[model samples]
Target: MPRIAYFGPQGTFTEQAARTFGDADLVAVETVPLVLAAVRSGEVDSGCVPIENSVGGAVTATMDALAEDEPLIAVAECVLPVRFSILVRPGTRAEDVKTVASHPHALTQVHDWIAANLPNATPVASTSTSSAAVLVQDGEFDAAVCAPVAVTHYSLETLATDVADVDNAVTRFLLVSRPTRVPEPTGADRTSLAVVIAHAEPGSLASTLSELALRGINLTRIESRPLRGQIGEYRFYLDLDGHIGEERVAGALAALHRNSNQVRFLGSYPKADQSPSVPSAKNTDDDYQAARDWVRRMREGR
Candidate 1:
């Protein structure tokens, strides 16, 4: 059985995502770095960790790890519905709760609920929501805002269910492994890249993005993080709507390479939602191939 590492003590959203990645021997690590390190060191076959949430935005731990000097590559993407609950030790009444503990993202997800209901409860951060549940199990906390699954894991009781302020809360997770193990791209795939501009100029961001637009590549997400040790310098993380294997995507990346200082090819994997059908157009792969062939013919003649 494959040994998969996940950000967990168990029962966190990352564990749920690991399950979505398929059956495996799950190893629960305390932090995102541990999970990635396990994979990089060959201690595990793969690592699964949250990358983004619809409500709270990107999970910087996972994103920064990918951007850093790790020889890992994302192999798959898993998205899971996240539901938070106010869990407490059995026999702990809701009225007796004076503190709420959970992962920071989980805390923010249910902020309004906690404020409206627990009003004066002190909110504490834990490594993971399941860790918060463990705290309650050890009598360290009065209650925890964690996944419903965490209740059973730590023998806690749910004081409230679906406590998240947003009913549509979802967390996106990425399965990462060695660079040699990249997954074959589906036509309806997403290519992730960590791009650093050659200079921090006014139009640098726009110029880098224009390469994608010029090739008709649609951007699904773009986020910037400060470069380490470089004040006023930023690196962009992008998710664009095409596999790296596609012609237009390859062309765009080639252009980006010429325009940027460094372009880290994160990985290309199937989008969580399968490719939607085009009205009356050929499949993207066929179109890309035909277009490439035509362009090659024109270049050869020239």
Candidate 2:
């Protein structure tokens, strides 16, 4: 069985995502960076880490880690619905809770729920939701706001279930491995990239984006992170709706390479939702092939 490391203490949402990703020898690690490091060092076959949350937005740690160090690529992804449960020692009542511990993001998601339900309880931040349960298990906290799956790993009872400030929130997780042969392109796919513009002048970023726009490529997401030690400089992380093997995607990437000082191909993998991308008539594969053939004929004096 392939080994997988995840941002976990065994019961966090990332672990749940790892399970969804594949049947692997799942190893629980402390943080996102550690997970990627293990992958870089070949300590595991792959690492699973949360990348984006619908309620809280990008997980910066994962993004920055991916952009830095030896390159790693996401081979698969899993999206889990965000849900929190207040877990406590058996026989503990809601009124008995004085302090509730959870990861910062989890705390933020369940902030309002805790206020209305356990007004007297103070919120403490733990490294992760599963670790919060560990705290509660060790008598450090009165309750833990964690995923329902955490209860299976700890001797805790659920005081409340399905708690969240927003309905239908989901978190996206990536299964990353050291750079290798990319997965075969599925019709429904996503390509991730990290790009640093060649120039900081006006229209530089727009010029880079136009390459994709001209090819009819659809960008699913874009986030800017400050470049390390480069004051005011930023790296743009992108997710576009196609695999790297596609013609338009490859063309856009080639253009991006020419237009940017740095372009890191993160990976091209199947999208978790499996939604197919329908290309416009002008940008279809046949259109590109015909254009290439016509150019060849012109060169041959046809």
Tell me each candidate's TM-score: 0.84, 0.93
Question: Which candidate should be chosen as best, given TM-score against the real structure?
Answer: 2
lDDT of 2 by residue, 184-242 (tens): 77889999999986345678789878988999899999999879888757799999999
Screening candidate 2 with a backbone cut-off below 3 angstroms (N, C-alpha, C), the clashing residue pairs are none
* lDDT of residue 206 for candidate 1: 86
Q: What is the C-alpha lDDT of each candidate?
A: 0.82, 0.90
How many clashes would you count in candidate 2? 0
By summed lDDT, the worst window of 10 consecutive residues in model 1 runs over 276-285
Give candidate 2 regions above 4 Å deviation. none
Q: 1-302 in candidate 1: lDDT tens per residue?
A: 99999998788777878888878999999889889989989999999998998887999888889888776778789888877879988787766888889988788888888888887688999987877888888889899988777766778888898776888878899998888745555657888899986454789888888877766778889998988888777888999887777667777888888878778888888888887412124435567688778999999995
Worst 10 residues of 2 by lDDT: 196-205
